[model samples]
Target: MQTPATPKFTTREFRDVLGNFATGIAVVTSRDTEGRPVGCTINSFASVSLDPPLVSFCIDRQAGTFAAFQSHGHFALHFLAEHQEEVSRRFAKAGEDKFGAVEPVAGIGNVPLLSDCLAHLECSVYQRIDAGDHVLILGRVEAFSSRKDLPPLLYFRGRYARVASE
Candidate 1:
């Protein structure tokens, strides 16, 4: 195996560089073994495969909800709408009740589904790989919903942005 090369850029520099690329905000939700809901705001989500209907997202290894997501084996990814910045900020924090005000319905494998998103995907854990400082989770999409009328919430350069009306 080839050895990894040393990164010349500082962590802050790397983050700043990547932040130039905009990403849609998402809140990935799941239930713990005891059936309590958990979620976190994530912008690292992506569609991994179309043939098998797979999606993926990265979670910090030290996140408060990490263990629950890893063991539960199911989750739902909610793509936030442009008006859901409060929801995004709420989940982005490390807290016990990320779903405090939001009423989440149960999806596949009892994963909690948030409402009013531009889109959402219900998935089952397909695979988990160790990535630097995070875990890359691949999920098999089981169900999904979309509302084309709603614009997505976006993050760019450490701030929230919007898609201009066409």
Candidate 2:
């Protein structure tokens, strides 16, 4: 069957529309073969399934961490706490020492898990697919932990926000 044509929007318009959806921020981190830490700030992480314990996140096609994440075989996803905006900014910067300003612990096969996140997941890459300008990486969850007292950092409308309790 032929695909139906969808209305197209400018990149800025598209971003604005997508920004309306609130998402939790996370840093997806892995080490290169040389053991150098590589990571990127990601807002596209989500639970894919529970039966087999799978999760997924999107990495931009041009991100510096893409190759390392693909070749490293394993990685850790640290869910940012509301107070960790600096950590997110550090990871998002290009050509900067992301780990220098933060503390990380090697866990689950040497993947670096940032200290004091709201939660973290250590995973092994299970599958990958190219989609538009990003690659969707599916990981099989190997380990995970959460802190009950922490609130998550949220991204919405191109800004950071906290989820307020009613």
Candidate 3:
């Protein structure tokens, strides 16, 4: 087999290219060992399977909430509504109280569930895959809720965006 040539683009270049594809914003929340709510914003979430009801998201290894997610083994993924850009920005920051302003309800495994999202998925960690600079967390959906009437919060080109209504 012939070896493939290395890409000429830098990491920033690749990431900029990837920004062309729009994605929904989600806040993944879980409790630390002390039972305190911990969460972070993610745009890389996707449904993996239907029969088993699996969803997956990538967490940066260096994130503040990475340890909580690795140890807790359960979490709630909240798909933010179009008006929740501040919610997304809040969780995206590091080393601050993420749940201080937001109200949280206890979920399965005591994961923190954020209110007013377009959708919510309560899940248990099904598998963890080690990927470059990040860990892929595969979760088995235990419970879920959604509101089809709400438009989704989207991220595109490193900025929050909204979908056009017909």
For 74-155, candidate 3 gives per-residue lDDT tens digits of 9999999999999999999999898887779999999989988999999999999999899999999999999998899999
Question: Weakest 10 consecutive residues, lDDT, candidate 2?
Answer: 100-109
Ranking by TM-score: 1, 3, 2
Cα lDDT tens digits for candidate 2, 1-166 = 9898785878899899999999999999999889988888999999999989999999987887878977888989999999999999989898888888666888887988888899999999999898889989999999999999988999999999998897
Candidate 1 lDDT over residue span 74-146, tens digit each: 9999999999999999999986578877788989999999988999999999999999899999999999999
lDDT (Cα, 0-100) at 5 in candidate 3: 92
Estimate the overall C-alpha local distance difference test score of candidate 2.
0.91
Model 1: pairs clashing at backbone N, Cα or C within 3 Å: none
Q: Which ten residues in a row have the lowest lDDT in candidate 3?
A: 96-105
Q: What is the C-alpha lDDT of each candidate?
A: 0.94, 0.91, 0.94
